[model samples]
Target: MFRTALRTVLAHKARLLMTVLAVMLGVAFVSGTLVFTDTLGNAFNKQSAKSYKDVAVSVTTYYSDDDGADGKKQEPGLSPKVLDEIGAVDGVASVTPRVDGFAGVADPDGKLIGNGWSNTGTNFAPGENGKDPAYDFTEGTGPTEAGQVALDKDTASRGEYKVGGPVRVATNGPVKEYTLSGIFTTEDGAVNAGGSLVLFEPSVAQKLFLKPGYFQMANVTATPGASDTKIRGEIESLVPRDAEVQTGKQLADQQAADIERELSGINQMLLAFAAIALFVGIFLISNTFTMLVAQRTKELALLRAVGASRRQVKRSVMAEALIVGLVASTIGFVLGVGLAVGLRSAMGQFGAKVPAGPLMITPVAVAAAFGVGVVITLIAAWLPARRAAKIPPVAAMSSVHAVATMKSLVLRNSIGAVLTLIGAAGIIAGASMGKDGKFSIGAGAFFSLVGIIVLIPLLSRPIIALVQPLLNRLYGVAGKLAGQNAVRNPRRTGATASALAIGLTLVTGLTTVGVTLGTAIDKATTDNIKADYMITMAGGVGGLDESAVKALEKAPGVSAVSPQRASYLVIDGKDSSASAVTPGDIEQLLTLKTETGSLDSLSGDAIAV
Candidate 1:
């Protein structure tokens, strides 16, 4: 049976090409996502290790508070006193306080010179020899005075900055001018994850980037022959209660883990699209197998007449699917490796600091691709295989094709109607239940789609009949003939059309949702937003500084500007959120509709509820 199945597959290669292509596309998606994830993870891990090469211990604040309502964690501002204490810890060799913050820089053309993932700041104390281990000077010396700054090699080249060039830097405060004192290179020469890197003098950075007496973090190096574990332990005891100490390796591992978590989301999103492609492949595979079985009915009946058992005939069909899956999956895996390489470059262009590395192909990815392809193909081919096995030996004596019976039609229509009703009920109930109703909605959609497919044979003829006149008018004789041929075999025509309809339905649903969301956004902006213009940060990392808000309030042509603060809190063991705004300006800048109390009655520490 297997040999016969192999021969049949070889003979019908042209007819089965579409099925092969469908399976290959799905498997390629699965393999490409896995490979891309593995590659990015390796790159980040390598870079993180190099970033912390010189540090033995790191001291920073430990935040017990949840991230604010903007979904960003507030950086703990460490005082200069804490840095001195960490430096005085037993076994500490050297300490480098890092003053880091976002500083927007522009090229000569006034265009931003960053990939958005760039880091900008200064090393408060560049080591004893005036060189930071994390950074090496490529063109000139490190910044040592208030008006001087250093740029990374990539940033300098891209922004057209030279050793003596004057550059403007903008933080949350007003833009300031500084001399480009030097150009430096990090360990990898591509630090900040492919983003721009700018360094300034400690005093200048503290004044412009951070508040007075505050540092982002301090890196500690253990004395020669001192154990990192011992240094970390001693540093922890000296640090304040709000701060924590970690070994260099621990910090590196944590950074790698964070990167992995972020990248995993992208991998999962790609996998979801792959699953959709595979689902569509299932319909194509099933349709192809059904037609194949019908065309080969007489051949199967003749084998039965020659004493071949029904079980043997069924096995032959399944064997064919297995071979097709194996060939398609093997080719797909190879194609996927190439796709992964391309995706890495694409991500880099989007401002991701993807390190150049070899592609990583894990055993699990290969197994999953082949396993899913084979399983789906076999499952889709099962019904058609069974139908072929049911062909009686007497069928060999007849040349006519079998047609659907009245009893089968009645049974199918009845099941379809029941399924449609149940699916509609589930959708309604799910819609009424809010955020936790995802599973119900998904299951309902699946059932509804299947039910619609089941009714296609019954609905196809009438739908085509109604559209036939229009098609004929548009294309004349050719269109009329095509329409006539489509309705001639309703079962075959419906099967093909249903496959297309399912894909179209999903696309239409997504389009409608997108359009509705867009319209709602426009309505909300028109009705709720009262300001002529709003000032916001490009990245939602840190909040706009109070100093920046005050500066803006005094600017020319500016009316009243309101600052809103939001944070998350645990209330009664459940996560809750709160937002604060000025009580006096709230009415002027916003449209508040109160059911009971007036907006004017609000005051300090007042509870609106």
Candidate 2:
């Protein structure tokens, strides 16, 4: 039966060619999404590992994103006293206290470089060995004094700033020109994020980024034969109240997880498009198989007449589908890998590059590619195979066959109508249910799409009849005959049209919704914000410092400038995220729905609000 199926496919290569193409494209899209996502994840993992090179443990101030705003006001750093206590631990060999903050540098074109928001300024605190393990100096030794700064090699090379040249560096305050004391390269994410780096003397960085004598975090190096866990435990007791101790492996894992989370949305979106393509291909595959089965009705009947079992006939048909799936999947996998590499390179060229790493092809991606491809093909061919098996020898000999009846049509249409109604109701109810309705909304959309596709065959006859008159007027006999042929095989017409129909429907629906939502959001933002322009931190890492606020307010022709500082606090013993702004801000910058308190007396906590 398998040999017969193989011969049959080989005999009419042109007939099965469309089926192969459909399956191949579906598999290719799915496999490509997996490969690209995996590659991104792998690249980030390598970067995260590199960022923590040679560090035994990382002791950091435990703070949320909002906490960083507080840092800008008055940094809650691990004090130098705590650093001394941690360094005195039994297994601790050394401790390097580091302060980090955003430090932007413009290229000759006046654009901020290095993962734009990731341009870093950090303190260079070399151990007794006169070297910081984090940075490997290539041109000169570490910067030792207030007037010296070290630049990362990549950033230095890009900006044409060499050792001993004046390198201008900026913090939130002002740009200071310093002698480029050294140039180094490092694997740290803070330095290598396609952005420039400026390493200042320890005293200088501390004075610039935070208050003097305080460190943002301390990197601890353990003695030989010391377990990281043991040292972490010992140091935990010694560190400051606000500090959190974690081993190097824990820090690496956390960083990797954070990076994966950022990539998740893109991965899911691409995978969704892949799923849609595969789903739409199902109808195309089914229609192709149905046509094949109808054309080979006589052959199938002849096999049955020759004493071949019904099961054998069905198996033969399915075997052909299986072969097509295998061939298509093999080709698809290769193409998908190529697609991933191209996508990576394209993104890099456009400046959204990830850290360079080898392309990842996990076993799961391979299994999913072949499994989804073969299973989908089998499913699409199932009904046609069953019909071919049931073909009566006598009926086929007389050139008569039964593919569907009025009863089957009624049953199919009824099922589709029920699903469509259910989906509509689910969508409406889901919308009213607020944030908890995500599952309902997603399920409703899926069911609605499937139901509509199923009902397309029933809709075809009426739609074709309406178009027939227009067609006859436009092109006379050829158009009229084409319309009649489409109406005669509604299932075939529906299958052929579904792909285009679904594509148009989805695009139109999404565009309409997106435009409407965007307009509404625009309206809301415009209404809420009375100011002409809103100022925000580049990466939302911290609130605008006083210097930043003053800089904006001092701009020519500026009317009113208000700085809104976010603070997380416990209000009446419940956690609350508050925005601290002055009475002038409430009056001039924002249009609130209601203002209960008297503007003269109203006051808010911290940061002079």
Global lDDT of each candidate:
0.79, 0.82
- State, as a TM-score between 0 and 1, how close model 2 is to the true structure: 0.89
Q: Write the per-residue lDDT of candidate 1 for residues 1-609, one digit (tens) a residue.
A: 788899989988987888898889899999998988988888778888878877899877643456656777654567777677877877888888876767767777886676333545554367778787777787988888888888888778878888987988766656688898889877542355656677877877776656666676788888888899988877777665557678889988998899899888999999998898888888888878888887887888888888889899999999999999899888888888889999988876775557666778999888988998888889878977887787777854485445566898889888987787778877888899988887888788878888878888878888988999999899999999998888776677777887688789989989999999999999999788776777664454356778788887899987777888886568799987877877767656776778887767777766454
Question: Pairs clashing in candidate 1?
Answer: none
Model 2 misplaced stretches (Cα beyond 4 Å): 50-53, 63-76, 114-117, 260-263, 424-448, 568-572, 593-609
Span of 10 residues, lowest total lDDT, candidate 2: 62-71
Best by lDDT: 2
Q: What is the lDDT of candidate 2?
A: 0.82
List model 2 lDDT by residue over 370-439, tens digit each. Answer: 9988999999999989988888999987778765788988898999899988888888889989999878
